[model samples]
Target: MKMSEAFATTIAGVAPVILLVAAVEIGNRKEALREGYHLIGQRQRLIDELYAAPEAPTGLQLQAVAAQTDQPMQSATRDLFIALYVMSALIVGVLLLLAESLALVWLAGSQRGSHPLQAAFCLLALVIGFAWVMLAPMLGLVVAVADDAVVVISGVSRLRRFYRDLDTHDRQQQAADGEQT
Candidate 1:
């Protein structure tokens, strides 16, 4: 049965309480979604730049290049774009998992009175769980997004810093070369 959002009083007025709790839960989840969307949008330009950059150098060359903060530039901006895209794709699986989970939850909820919760002794028991039919993806998404973001962000930050340092070094070298000649 599709419970009306009209607000019912059930389990000794617990329905309203459930509704209250549900509303709060939903709001909290919406906040999380906001944060997720924010996270998704914040680095868009950088991500696009990254998407266009070269594939990140691998193995010993990677370490050598990365450690060469004081060295002259080897890779071009084109290289950064290639590297960025490749690095960005490293987390593609995580985003795919998010998309799949959302689609599954949405589909399952749309089914006619299907019991999606199969686990025994679920937290929050019945009412809260019922309220969370739509929110099933929230906690999981936040967790997934948060966990993967750190490594990706740090890696990209390093790459960006490296790019800037080398670019600066190349420019200075060019100027010095021009002066010496």
Candidate 2:
């Protein structure tokens, strides 16, 4: 078979998978954005509560703030979801571009009936696909690690602020109660 025909066949086989991967990546990004917004809303609500109370909230109000904070903290825990989506989109684009380049090379290399080169092209395509599959988990791991680091830093900051606010609120409450008594 001619190299052009083989290259076309290879592309035909690979394009669907590339497109599918891209689609999945886009979906993940959308989900991440959705969750991010949800967390942002929760955080905003906490800020609202902190502002709305006439005096420092006590007991149940404090508990409510703590409960609301949990959702944002939990949602922010993973950085990988966003990173994976970006990486997957990038990988898919690279793969598609590489496939086109390979097809061009195959067309240029073909001279008369050269089935061996076509076989080699097919093998390379398989190898590339397999390599991507193997590399995906590693990419995910990198994203997850980076995300964890950010979460740790942010969580600490948030906790510090929370504790400070709670302490101040407790002091104010004690003063108010003493005055009332």
Candidate 3:
């Protein structure tokens, strides 16, 4: 695939997908925690009423309250939960970027004399693509486009270097054959 196409796919998989998932999960967690805290508050009120009256509550109901009294409450601050959600989303996005890029490469179709260093090129491309994906919104459209273009430009240079190396190897082989002759 063309470098732009590959890079675009990487950006797509990372940016939109991760942002969407993270927002949804963070919202869900925040709502759930709010409800849990509400329950805890109601439990405290129930215990206060029981102490004030000491009658009218069933034995089983008191036992149930006692059972839950010492239960550990696990909760995180909003900052902590948001941080975790964003981090988790990033990890998944990185994996998705790798998968999408690899699929793009496979679909690009192999050519005869493709460089041995093609895998290396892909690795570097991914690094740049990832940087662009993460920073694009902050960097503005023009800068992001340049950043994206770098991946494609570097791939071109790599192709040229690979062919140059092949040319040098061919000439050396020819010279060695002449010497033998």
Candidate 4:
């Protein structure tokens, strides 16, 4: 087989794998988001319970609640974010590989053909492939980074709220003890 044919075949073969991996990554991320949202709901419920009564909960109780709810939220968010990043990287890599393969194919085909029109077609394919490879990552990176930033910000906000609630309870307990004395 000619080098052009081999290169085209390789790109075609790899494209399916890229598509499959992207699909799986998207599914995993969706599931993680669902679980994370569930955990967020649980955490809200715990907060509501804490606020309903004046009595402060013990440190152990707070820790237990955090373990039950916060940990899972953190884990799911982290896993999903990492998976998304990896998926983006893989897509970028695949695009680059395809570009290289197309370039090779174009060069090989140009050398094999005598007709100017045939050579032009190969060159056009090469240019298109290169442009796509160069552009895809720029777009993908912007999207991935934006998503990661949003998740990180939301996670930090949740943690801050949790700790703030714990602090308020501790201060109330201190005030009550002083009144008793």
Candidate 5:
């Protein structure tokens, strides 16, 4: 078979696996985002409880907050997300191994001794091709599933900001109370 024909056939054979892995990764991201939103809602509720009274919350509210924080991470939903990440990572690893083997075979069969520069160029091209194929699909899947978390993956920073704002407000209130007294 011609070189181009072989390349086309090999890619055709691999495309389905790559597509399937990408779909799984996208689904994982979606579910993870859903779970994250649920956890954030729980956290917001806890925060509301803490701010409900003029005085500090009692031990019961603190226990409820701790439970809410731990529930999401400890649940089966998180296990499924972790499993998807592992499976997708394994699929990507297999694809990389296959690409590396193909590159090695192509290098061995081609007349590399005759033109060292051409051989080097071919190796570089193979690396670039592997990177494109390996990363592009995953990147596209990530972008598609990003939703509101496109700029911030974990969203921990947003929570931190909220907490900081609350602290500042509380400090100001304390200062006002002291001044009034």
Candidate 6:
């Protein structure tokens, strides 16, 4: 293969590796988000318990409760999102490199005499360009979808836990009432 062809092929190989990295990264991120979301939800529940009594907690007590409950959740969210952002950036970098390399090959071939093969190379370059252009926006959309999904999943999970706790409390209260009667 010609130098340009060889370089383009190498670049093409890189594209797949980049895609694999992106997939793995996204999957890892999703798992982390799920774990973090559940953990934070658990913390929020603990804080809610502090407010369960008829008497309101004092301001100092509330502040202490917030400090204890919010730290781990905040840490988890920050770490997960940072990882996602970095991986998404890597996906964009690889896509751009692949497209540019192909475009370079097309440019080199055009400098020589035009042939039927040139059209094929040109088409390949166009496709690469389109893919590169689309990758960033598509990744953004994926991240947005994932974010919304995590939020909804966590909310529903928290609600389920809340209702279950409420049911248990009610049952216990009824049992005590029956014993007294």
The lDDT per prediction is 0.43, 0.66, 0.55, 0.60, 0.57, 0.62
Per-residue lDDT of model 4, residues 99-130, tens digit only: 54554555555464343443344344444444
Per-residue lDDT of candidate 2, residues 7-126 (tens digit): 656665675676566566567567666777677787888878687978977788777788878657655645445555566567655666566566656555645355566546555655
Worst window of 10 by summed lDDT in candidate 2? 76-85
Give the best candidate by TM-score. Answer: 2
Q: Rank the candidates by lDDT, best first.
A: 2, 6, 4, 5, 3, 1
Q: Give the per-residue lDDT digits (tens) of candidate 5, residues 1-181.
A: 2234345345445544554655665565666566666776777777887889899888987887777676554444443544555565565555544554554555456543344443344344444445655775566456445533543555788889889999999999999999999
The candidate that achieves the highest lDDT relative to the unseen native structure? 2
lDDT of 6 by residue, 49-161 (tens): 88898898989888887787765654564546645665655656555555656545655564643334533554454455456445644665666577667778988989999
- lDDT for model 4: 0.60
RMSD of each: 16.1, 10.9, 30.1, 11.5, 13.1, 11.7
Clashing pairs in 6: none
Q: Report the Cα lDDT for residue 153, model 4.
A: 93
For all candidates, the clash counts are 12, 0, 0, 0, 0, 0
Total backbone clashes of candidate 6, pairs 3 or more residues apart or in separate chains? 0
Candidate 2: stretches off by over 4 Å: 1-8, 48-62, 101-181
* Model 1 Cα lDDT, one tens digit per residue, 104-181: 443446453323342111212333444343444354455455556765797899999999999999999999999999
The TM-score-based order of candidates, best leading, equals 2, 6, 5, 4, 1, 3
lDDT of 3 at 175: 100
For model 4, how big is the CA root-mean-square deviation? Answer: 11.5
- Any runs in candidate 3 off by more than 4 Å, and if so which? 1-5, 48-181
Error of 5 at 15 (Å): 2.1
